[model samples]
Target: MKPTIIRPQGLPDSVSSPVVTPIMPSVVYASDTPDALDAQYEGRTSGYTYAREGHPNADVLARRIDALEGATGGIVTGSGMAAVTAALLGLCKAGDHVLGGDQLYGRSLRMMRDDLPRLGIETTLADPTDAASMEAALRETTRLVLIEVVSNPTLRLADLDGIAALCKARDILLVVDNTFTTPRAIKPFEQGADVVLHSVTKLLAGHSDVTLGWVAAKDPDLQRQLYDFIVTTGLTPSPFDCWLAERGLVSFDLRFDRAQRTAETLGRWLAGQAGVTRVLYPTRDDHPDRARAQALLRGTGGNMLSFEIEGGRAAANAFAAAAEGVAFAPTLGDVGTTLSHPASSSHRGLTPEARAAIGISEGFFRVSVGLEDPEALQDTFGAGLAAARGAR
Candidate 1:
């Protein structure tokens, strides 16, 4: 009358579970034959030679993410930016150029804008939501095109089909950052994506605890190259972080579903508020790219909302202070509803005019709806909106 997974042989055939993987923090592996070690070192064999190169926990997490993203292979990294940077480095040579989104996670933009150029890899920016703008930004030297599935802070949607087609026709790799939308909502690989990126710190893990990132690709050869690069650069995550992230994955859908429900309720409420300037959610009728979002994400809306108040930065700060349950987290995608101010937090490194150009105004604040009662969130966020109104 009970259902269970088939355990491997020698895994205690009784009620015991031998297949359940545990946190494996072993740094060095013991091998009897020199040939075995050499094979592992040379990538001829698929086995752990060292934790810095790969380990049990990271492998388990990577496999799960690989399956979820519909990729042939994947690898976990120390941090989200590490994953992105490492993948870019693996794909690009000294003279190669990259075309990336104008609206990205602040740190991601900064890395491409500042660091990549220093390494002789040029990066050009384009609004991925616009076909014409993206086409104009691509260069003959462009080897990769990076797109965020849902633009951070602003919640803009990317038209994946157009971008994918454009990149494919040019023999350029299309890498989709699926952190904002998560795999539960959208699988970029289905849209002709060459690879997919995730800040596993977000909805994939479904908790604010783990700091991890990963890249998944359909090509096994590319995966091997990425893994080799990871080993050479020491970009692997700790086994403990890998375990925690995988643990969070078990409940990701449940948490994301509940949070999305709350987000929808809060989005509708926020839009109707007299003092609120605008609410940005993919499902909203007023969203500029709602149709594109529907097409790419298969009608699944995300659990993120961006709103503006009348009083600019002052009001945004005051609003956070007034919220009853919503906490100000420098991060996004927490199981508990959290708030972030893009201008002062994530995108603070940019100039005022630069931030404004991306539709991030001084009054803009983003809300990552969590697994709270919709009514409670409405009350909490409503208080903040009301406070912002009073602050003006």
Candidate 2:
């Protein structure tokens, strides 16, 4: 029997619509016209005359992400940092000020602290968990308020609705990094965020094979502005990378669901174990923002969890070295569980004082759970804990 090719309706068999499939080279120039060629040759218009500006695959991924986030539209970028930089630069000008959350991604912290200020854009970091503190930090020149739906190493959940309301009242754009809580788990736009960003390298892609980023916004104008900046600045994702991301999205729901369940089980098990000083999972009872997290996040608390060891840096390093089955790596949101020592890896650029300010202690370890059996994962940690404690 000849193979039957099943293509998504309204999309060519070569390309996935809702999710992009690989396209054949033969189809690349199928739609090119003499007029289009002339326009490209003449550098005529702002429309997609080249893939650098826009491509069908990237556009589809953007639309799918926008639908998932319940936003007007979205733009895909080459990397998470590109998405963040594009969003921040597109929204604010030289004289503008940005009010950002305290527990941001380390690279984002660097951008805000080092780069933006050099360009005359000032920033103030606030603890979004403390609404009073966030309010107090806002200034008259503030043009944007940025927060992560869930922070990188700490797993701290920001008050999205509260921050959105604050930004709305102050006429500032509310930019949220929704990397930890992918659209499968939470939609920040639905919760009142003006713009939602994602490190598609993480949960959104799920496979850890691609590096892509996205920004979803409620206002069409805002979306257009961001898209324009991204294209003009040449920070857009390649067609191939966009296709990989789209394929990843097809399995995002199932992957995240399984990972979240494993995370919850591990979080509870770790909380009960000896030599574990603290477990910071959003669903845990002792979490400071548990109530707010429950109120805002729709599905599971997510796969990322952070814990501090009883014996500080030495113990943490020992546990990380002794851990079996899971990979002790810097990046997160992969099919295989990976661990990060933020004080040294992600947040290394920050001063010791800055790291301490965000509760990222020397003993802390951030775990990104994967789709592995809960019992196997638990036993691995149990052995690692024993080894770590013995070393002390």
Candidate 3:
């Protein structure tokens, strides 16, 4: 059911309608009879009986995200990590095996490598930059193949369609982390992904305030199972957070479009700037996976780019400290430009060898371009470059 759209006061009751939905933080809903409440509990009825099981606010946000992904259903979790944990547990048993990309978010990699093992699931990691690495990692016991659509920090593109086709032939589920590329940028379901997950704290939420994660799937059984897991594990988000996320969706498209444009501008600018060794944005011709990125991604390669500052970590720190208008947050996808050092932040948990394998060197820094003016970004980065080149 659609949320009621209220008309504003004194506008002839026709010209204005509320563009936002009200927050529903109630933990329980009324039921006429025990039978009705039982039916709701058993998923036979439509109303929400309990917040942990299901909340009206979360349901609205889930439906919104699923609609964006062209999915059958979606669920909002307490965090993106919760979404991953719930989805994986919902799909696999104790003995099930899984495969994934080598370059993943540190926490996710740990979950697949450390936590899942303690829970009796096995996982193998390999470079997902090409189909060969993915093919080599597959096992007879593999139940799911997980990959990042674009790798963290490095911004490398995965052969999404290629891996998806392989998973189909093997009858294994394919899951893609769509955080870097939101549904507005790419629909993984259309590319053969069985499931898509996002840390809505990033692009979907737009602002840097809320912490949310969501999972979307085009399969009825998987969706039901995921919902059950969320409810049982108490990973569902609070109504207030879900409500704020729903509001964020109101301007998601515009934010994504502007961010993508700004990223492209910065990618090009960084490529020619002094003290910049290389840019790893997927849209660049020099990128090894540019062709694959073109085949899989829509619009530009997204609003993320990782560059090698000529002067190493010290220079990277100088750049961030010297840039006037930019903020150096440990996170990304905010409306304002932010910088992060993967070696110290996002990929800090990985070993030196592991980080090197993913193209994260001592000088590497990832920049998330925001909706700020292109010229302003140029000047900010220019100061950063001056620091790196020892001119400042």
Candidate 4:
């Protein structure tokens, strides 16, 4: 006998129940009925009264993300920064403090350093890999402990479970940025994180086409608060973008798996190269947090890897220009591999001292391996390394 197939009720033949509706209907609201007016005007109802506040497509994506992250619920935003900003603002009060990992996305760092302070939310940066430092940094006024599963430029793995245990004892909300790992590799909530955030533009989307963000939380109250903030602040995603993200998520597992394999291969090759000084990838035995990464990550290391060149900025730029198969660009997790210099592209906004403090060297380069042939990518980097050496 064929295996039984269970389908969700009211779903069409082609689309899954968790997928967005193909056709959006136009409804005319009658102002005469008091009940209808109350349902439409009052935001208490759990329906999409307005597209900006909520939409069927957005809800579908949010539900899918929540399920993937194993969270009670989730909210989709226009951009990754929107997700980060809303998550922080929703959970933190005016006088509350936030402890963040030192190696956060450059834009996120700017938001914490410049924007949040203006709103009376103070933040302190700590090395996420160091549990003792994070524990010591936490204060009585700390409402949230923010950590990225993998640091951006350095590709260092954070000790999520250790940090979570620390935060749990202090009654602090543990917010994890799982953009680098994606849901296919690791679910932060299952690892003791209270909330998980993602920049869907990266590996989650799999193709660098659409920009979206998500916040998944275990607490129903926290999810509700995040949804309220998203709706009220008009930071919701567009229907078309939501649809694109949904399509991207369908093949996420395959893309992430292939890309991660390629990344690991490239990372190992780079580590053995003469011009490359330091290679940062969690799966590598030389990685400082290799054991911690093995404990936290479920699948391959991830698609992102970074290395420092021996000759610094000029050599790095020359190497990037000589790269063939991998495009010399800042954006990551694309169908085609892309590269960027952290000191210039993503972390350029930081002051010299600040950049140095974060360990973003002038010669450092970050590579986002894509769904390309592993050999082709390795050759491309090999050529780039040769060019860097020649330049030196």
Candidate 5:
């Protein structure tokens, strides 16, 4: 998700504390003296020499996110996957074992399963919701443990406290993907995560207009390690994207509150709908991990939820066609409501049997709730349910 380098406007001599964050797009900064340049390079002074190395916009966003996540320090990356890769590369060496939740985001699971192995880092997938299972999967060489605060598509909650405690006792770094449950709902650092990762492309950006991510480390040394990896690999995000993401953060709390409220309303409505067989929402009493959700999350279930339409792919497609205002977009965390079919989108890479084993049935549709009026949105979903029934 490399962005096109947009030439920035001419630099001003200085702006006296502009209300808005100014996007500094210069790829390189000039130093007044060789001593100063060496000082910056040696980390004896704070400065930006290259965009790939550091930039004011990224530094601002990183600081903001670090505060939000209660992290000791942080770094921004070009994308979510890049953040994951950077964290793993910084922390693990060849022969080190990385244990990740089986239900992590598809690409993340792929990186651990298929990609990291190539680098001589071994990865094991375990049930993140079950602390005992995670303990059983750990090996003497295990160096990192990864889990999503909430499983993708299914809305399953992970036992973060338990998992974090397990990792702490064993001296393994615990990485939690806070993409689904953004800091608005829960901060992984408070729950004992060594590193917190986000797809700023999602909720943190809110508008679905940016491709960026960040890694927040609980330790300063760990943050430097991740930062060095990002800079060395040229994985820093463009200044423009970082600026947009910062702007998005301005309304993140408000947008997330509204969307999550509507998600609760929609979840209740869908549970009683004609064609919906089951609904997966953290706030729902019947959710598989309700107890954990109650203990770990704020009162709200996140803005994301999934439901099983009566028919498989056919009903799902028919529902999408009839869900008037809702776009059948594969992505999530937009300001507008959109539907994603995991069978055909997020989890499509998995074999049919593999998906089924994880409860991602052909009929499942994950919804990224938005700021739409709840009643009207329910009406829209009602119409889609009728169409789904007809298709069945």
Candidate 6:
């Protein structure tokens, strides 16, 4: 008999060879034969031909998102806006009408209201929390309805089930941005959402190192179309970033759970504070849609919360300075707790009237709670509150 094998029993097989998924940075791939290459290009075989079309790393990340979002199929893109652009332009054509929630992300609103119109696709905005408002805004040509599970900056929870039902009855495709209320909180597809979107740069990545996005469709055909659009438009994300994001996803559950706990604690403490006029957290009793949030999110308030200062923008600035250790970053979803001013960062594109209409005022402070000690965060917040009061 031959000498005993030195390697492990399963190591020889490629499938079980490595515990960590490898990062494939190849811009181009080679096949065993010409016929195999043709088959790969024609979708007759499972393989990669070029990075622009697809890559193993991206596919790995996309499949993870599919599993998380409970989607039939999915694809990764360069950025959050790229995913939005591909989904809109690929599925809806000229003369097609789209209805968007008035409280959607700032860039998304700008795209629908300003950019899509130039492409002959028109959009209408309505209060996403009210199904009646959405129904009233729909046109005969309405093909899509877009809404966020939880609105940004202010963290308002939408009536996802109601809106999904409305879209289903009308045969309109319901696309939901699940960036805020990640898969850990709720699955929109179960509520009749046809498509789900994620800004992977935020909570999904958890580290704030990668800028990426993904689109998942309940319909396989729609997913194929979106993938084709992404490939043709070169909206594919970098393979390395996809690898990094995949690593981040490994710790997503732990991060999200910790953030959720801290957010709830902070929201309650802020509400009891003197300088805070209003605190908006989905799980809070005073939240406008607390009941809805409870039902949809399973009593879990997400990590994001916003509060208003007794003073306006000036007080907000003073609070930021007093809240030491909390970085005043314009972005969100990092492992470290951070603060963002929506009026200047996420909602800067909107007019002052539009911003005020959505209640995103100068003094509003949105916090993306991170894995920090609850008492420590409260101490910083207490100092910030005192500063705000003095500033006013």
The best candidate by lDDT is 5
RMSD of each: 6.0, 5.7, 5.5, 7.1, 4.5, 4.8
lDDT of 3 by residue, 221-263 (tens): 8888888888899997988888888888889999988888888
Across 1-392, the per-residue lDDT of candidate 2 in tens digits comes to 98865642244465435332554222223225788777764668433456666777887788878778887668889999899998899888998999888878888988888899999999999887777789999899999988988887887778777788888888888898988888877878777788889889997888889999988678888888897888789996877778888888888889988999999999999999988888999888899888888887864689999998877778887888888778988998898899889988998877888788888788889999999999999999998899889877
TM-score, cand. 6 vs. native: 0.94
lDDT of each residue in 106-223, candidate 4, tens digit only: 8888877888889999999998988988988988899998889889888888878789899888889999988888877788888888888989888777687888999877888888
Selected candidate, larger TM-score, 1 vs 5 = 5
Off by over 4 Å in 3: 1-19, 42-44
Please report the TM-score between candidate 2 and the true structure: 0.89
Which residue pairs show collisions in model 5? Answer: none
Off by over 4 Å in 4: 1-34, 37-46, 351-354
Cα shift from native, residue 356, model 5 (Å): 1.5
- Residue pairs in clash, model 6: none
* Model 4 backbone overlap count: 0
Clashes of each: 0, 1, 0, 0, 0, 0
lDDT of 6 by residue, 1-392 (tens): 87885533222446456688887787877678899888877878898888999899999999898888887568899998888888788899999999999888888988988999999998999988888888899999999999998988778778888888888888999999988899999998998888889889999998889999999888988988898899999998999999999999999999999999999999889899997889999988889998899899998887899998888888988999999999999777899999988887888777888789889888888899999999999999999989989999
The regions of model 6 sitting more than 4 angstroms off are 1-16
What TM-score does prediction 3 earn?
0.92
lDDT of 1: 0.85
Cα-based lDDT at residue 180, candidate 3: 89
lDDT by residue for model 5 (1-392), tens? 97865755346687566899989888988787999999988989988888999899998888888878887568889999999998888889999999999998889988988899999999999998899999999999999999998999888888798899999999999999999999888988888998999999998998988899999788888888888888888998989999999999989889989999899999999998877889999988899899889889967688998999778878888889999999899888999999999899888888999999999898899999999999988989988888888988
Q: What's the lDDT for candidate 2? A: 0.83
TM-score for each model: 0.93, 0.89, 0.92, 0.90, 0.95, 0.94
lDDT of 1 by residue, 240-293 (tens): 889999988988888878888788888998888988888998888999889888
